[model samples]
Target: MPAGVRVTLRTDSSSLVCRYQADPAPTLNGPGERARIDVVCDGRRADTVKLETHGGDAGFRCEGLPGRMAAPGH
Candidate 1:
């Protein structure tokens, strides 16, 4: 990791966010290898959130949905 090579992602309200420290010597297309720190946040239906990443390999993807909303009462 290098100084000033950090990635940060936040929501419009700035309530939900993520931060990642960049790795200078990153390995791509390898097993158990990561170039960036991975972070996730869920609004749980109360709000909508977006994700972003930086300072790592050019190829990276984040996928998944937030927790399901609770049924009417329980």
Candidate 2:
């Protein structure tokens, strides 16, 4: 992944799971510093996700998300 890259997904469930495989060589920051990912919901900032910098296959889980609700009318 490069700078200014964005990944988006849509789900109806109130929970989300994100997984990624990364190598430590490409990381400019050290293990002590972690990247912060901004999670956007409906074009608005909903939450901030802090990534684990240890590298390799790892993921994060988010619960209690404000999922989309059915409107009054179809």
Give the best candidate by TM-score: 2
Backbone clash count, each prediction separately: 0, 0
Error of 2 at 5 (Å): 1.4
* lDDT (Cα atoms) of all candidates against the true structure: 0.40, 0.64
lDDT of 2 at 21: 76
Could you give me the TM-score of model 2 versus the true structure? 0.67
Off by over 4 Å in 2: 24-26, 69-74
Per-residue lDDT of model 1, residues 1-74, tens digit only: 33345344443343333444446534456565444433334423333232233555234444353434334432
- Number of clashing pairs, model 2? 0
Q: lDDT of candidate 1?
A: 0.40
Model 2 Cα lDDT, one tens digit per residue, 39-68: 666666777876654447655666767777
